[model samples]
Target: MTLEKKQPTPTAKPTADDEIDLIALAKTLWDGRRKIMFYLLAGAILGLVFALASPKEYTANTTMIPQTGSSVASKLGGLSSLASLAGVNMSNVGDKESLPPTIYPQIIQSIPFQVELMNTPFKCPDVDQPVSLYDYYIDYKKAGVLENVKKYTLGLPGLLLGVLKGEQEEGALLDSTLASSLISLTEDQDKVVKILNEQISLEINDKEGYISLSSRFNDALLAAQVTRKTQSMLQDYISRYKLDKANEQLKFIEARYAEKKAEFELIQNELAIFRDRNKYITTATASTQLEQLQTQYNLAYTIYSDWAKQLEQAQVQVKENTPFLTIIEPVRVPLEKSKPNRPLILIIWIFLGGIIGTGTVFGQELYNSVKERWSE
Candidate 1:
């Protein structure tokens, strides 16, 4: 009993089933090496084809600081009344009444803005003169070899549907005529609008109060040109919104001034004609008529003069309200292509292939294991 008690208890070692078979795992991978290599080879070939086939693009961007009328008013702190005249609220220095920079992105995204951009003329290849994007897309552009292949292969379903349903005709989609109150977009126009939306972008930094407007295109010159155009349009739109109320007031004043001028002229002419006709007619009727005409003339003159002054002030207000979108970094032709990172694409495809191949090998292993157990 003493001898038996002196013997040490045996420690249980890990079972084969519980332990990771690293050597077996390596062997499994090694066995599927050919399959993995095939996938890798296929991936590399596809990546090379895609990289070569992809079109090149350039990005052009302009950074701007939105200097509103309020900014100007802040600089002229001495003139308290000047701020009010300039449509700047002294209490709130940011000119909150006007459209904020956040909404500027939406302005760029608007259908009207896209349509206007598409209609703009630019120099094109093989064309002697400038041509609009709409005309170029519809009339001049012919699909390339790769594009045709894609159209027939990847886009074959849509093509078949178009043939069966009758392809929608592409033509002038916008009506600038006064007769049409509603703005409608046809398929062709919608396609272009979508492209425009993708090509153009506006990023605003609220804290710093700055904006970045950018455009991308296949042509470097076109990318820069479009970016410049986009900047101009954005500035114009924001300025228009900023001074909208001031401009309306100016118009009202203008109309009133015109009417008052006409009335004043008529009254003056009547007074002159009456004086000329009755040069020496001295009677109660004549005296009363003269007095009344004189009164009318004075009243008209005063009103007309007041309106004239208001008209001038309103014009000043409109001018004062105009904002400056100070360009921080002007757009320039991009020296490098922005899209189709070939090496990255190739690496990604190769990595994806490796993953899929490893998964397939493991899956086959799992299926065989399950089948063996079922048969047993």
Candidate 2:
């Protein structure tokens, strides 16, 4: 009867052997302190070398506000209905023809644009000469000893691949006018283009209708000059594109005006000769002939006058459609370098080194633990 009342015993809690010991982990890290310090010191030294070896870059920036044709809508108002009848929508057509500020950056970064920019002449104060970007990159940009070491060490694989590919012949430099139609590039030109792309930057603010163009180079003066040139080129290109239709219309009008003027003059001269020849003649036939010549001259003169007015209007339209780039902030030579922040670079290196060292320590501990378990 008493055995029925017996109680079940509780299992004992797991002992400390199954739990982690923070103290022991700390001791292990302490034992590896020297190794960590050595690794960290090595990393810091490497960072210092890299920071010192890095080339200095100066940046030049310019801001431009795009002035679109304001009177375009009014100018096309009379033709709006005609356009609609012809199945062409004229609503907001002016806005459509004018490029948005957002596209400015893309245009600058385009291959043809970059190619033309590379060939643009820039005066470099450091080199004491005016040179194209291609020439400047190849001939004037001297690498430091540390940079040479990195090229052979860190960039060894790329160097070997380039060597295997063999050297490529330089292509003829393209002019702005010719470069617009270029579809391809030579190996040397491609290399220069890649570098040019990296050096140039464009920022567009559509809401404000402004664009900021910047160029970075080792020489301050060159950076400013290149940025200025790029801005000018972009303005010219956009203006030409916007006014292209207007210009063609103007040319046609001028030609027609010339033709009409000659016809009007000839008709007037024929009428005058008829009057002079028929002076004091009262015959019905002579009067009819003179009247017909006079009527022809009047028609020709009216047509010529209309064409002359049209020619003047076309000229005005071309001028009105021409886009203007208002320079909000002009490019200026930078007095200070834009890149190579030595202190920041050094700090980044130190932090990376610490991480590597910590990882190494934990990896060693893990290896030791696995080995001990295997022995057991």
Candidate 3:
């Protein structure tokens, strides 16, 4: 039996079915392309519309490096004393007590600083045409959010009105609204002169030990005024803190001076008595006693003079109110607007639109697939 080697069974060539259905996917996309394009065009149009309608905003930033030595340093200086009292490790306590750079930033953003700004002349240049900074913040010109809220509530029926009357809410609301309006109106005039005090921004970079102050208004001059006034306000705050120390020193000196003056007056009286009692005008013993009295008087007079000088110095220093804060850079009026970044806004809108459009396309495709299978 001459059997030729059996040929291996022939395998069939793979059909396109074994591969991914890329053409079907392409067709699906092609069918949905009009809808996708429409949505993209709509998004672009809306973005353009917003860009046109948005108000132009300008930003002015001033940077300041914090001083190396501050009040906190002085407060934490005598750590050894605290450590001894607490019976803890001086190093740990001292380290713990040391004020970090972050604290200054927090101070910059604190309510005290905000209240101080409120009392000063920090105007917002963005919105104040004739309105004050406070008014601009509250959006008082045309149906502000608060006004809208009130109008909406008032439009609602009986229950709200009853509640308002029952709680004496109407009076409180009127007072609040009136106060708000007054704050908006008079913010410019009540500056302790004439500048609004509600539009200062304090931005602190703790890592860099820098602070940036900013303000806004319709008038460039007003913005500049606010910036300068804020610095002055900070100076005043520092002065107030040291005012007590100056007063204390003054009081101490004054009290001692008064005592010395009284003693000197008594010595004078004693000298006069001695003169009156003694009949002899040229007695050696009398002369010697007079010299002793003169010496005592001179000593008292010297003490009084020293105390007077100290009191004078304290008063002068107190009046000066200098705390030695260094201004790294002064604030200047910003020429350019800093808000409503058009390119950034466009990018964000485009990105969000693309995501939404893609998701919509996928969702529709899934729904169509399920529907076709159900019909089949």
Candidate 4:
């Protein structure tokens, strides 16, 4: 049986169907070149149209270096320990209260800040006259066709809901009286705020102690104005926050000083009257009365003097606590458009079109292969 099995075993040869043919695949793609080119051309044309229709935006930027008053910390140094012992926290003591540059972005995005910005009048190139940003956005601004298309497509649900709700009455959802409270925002106000938020940007460099503020708008001058206004508003807000305690102290001191001054003056007048009326008397009871009046005058004068010094000190503290914003690079009108990068847009479109065309060609091949297999 072993001798019979000594015959040679035949080796299996590879079949043509099992081998991959790159040339054939290439030919298949070449056969659909027209379809591929058509898709690519369509994509490119759409991109060009979008690029042409897109609105131009101008960006204006300003750089600033915040001047932190370390003197405030020094002034509060002695009080910090006392405050801690009394279970009262003091932030200004030992650089604790000094806001970091990072929080600046939050300040710009704050509701109160946005409200003020919206109410601010901006010079628009398209408009014959300057208009408040709120009015400009709400009344005059027109959405582009593409923007409307996107709204109807991606934002359809929201749009439909808004329509169902009907035109909201002014102040129906928002309490304008609470604007000073900053606790709430109305729907209209919120919309304007959101728009403002999109238009403004803040960049902080903590290590360098500098900040860059930027604003984008349809008009170059308006963009520059907005940037400058934002810087001013930020400076004002920070200054008010920094000097809050000092201002309160000053107010109290001023009120006390006024009361003391009036009391002192009244006492002086009384003392003078006593002296004038009792002139040349030379009696023990009269001398005693004179001494009593003199004593009262001295006490009132002393209290008034002390408060005067305190009032002066409080005034100094207010001045010292006021923060200064040193503008490194002031805002200027942009000469060039900041957005609508046409060339880049065109390139991206072409690249996407090529990808889509290639995918279409391969997808067609896959569909045909599946169909043939199913038929078999």
| Best of the two (1, 2) by lDDT | 1
Instruction: Rate residue 92 of model 2 by lDDT.
Output: 43
TM-score of each: 0.70, 0.71, 0.54, 0.72
In candidate 2 the C-alpha lDDT for residue 159 amounts to 90
lDDT of each residue in 1-376, candidate 1, tens digit only: 3655576545433445335477678889999999888888888888888787777789998999977544322433443353244343445332335566778889999989888988999886666789887777777777666778988999999989988998554434544573277667777788788878888898988888889998888888888988999899988888777677567656755775787799889999999999999999779999899999998898777767766766676677777745468899999989999987989888888888888888888889889999999999
lDDT of 4 by residue, 1-376 (tens): 3665575544333334334466667887798899888878987898898888888899999999987655443554354454354344546334434556778899999888898888998887667788989888888889887888898999999989989988766556656676555466667678889888999999989788788999998779989999999999999888877688567656765886797789889989999998889889779999998898898788777667766776677688777745467888989999999988988887788878888888889898999999999999
Off by over 4 Å in 3: 1-23, 65-131, 135-199, 216-222, 248-317
- Candidate 4 C-alpha error for residue 233, in Å: 0.9
Q: Provide the clash count, candidate 1.
A: 0
lDDT leaderboard ranking: 4, 1, 2, 3
**lDDT comparison, 3 vs 4, better candidate:** 4
Candidate RMSDs in order = 9.2, 7.8, 11.2, 8.7
At residue 248, candidate 3 shows an lDDT of 60
lDDT of 3 at 134: 46
Candidate 4: lDDT over CA atoms? Answer: 0.79
* Per-residue lDDT of model 2, residues 101-185, tens digit only: 7777788888878888888777765667678887777787776777688889999999999899876554346666787776767
Prediction 3 global C-alpha lDDT: 0.58
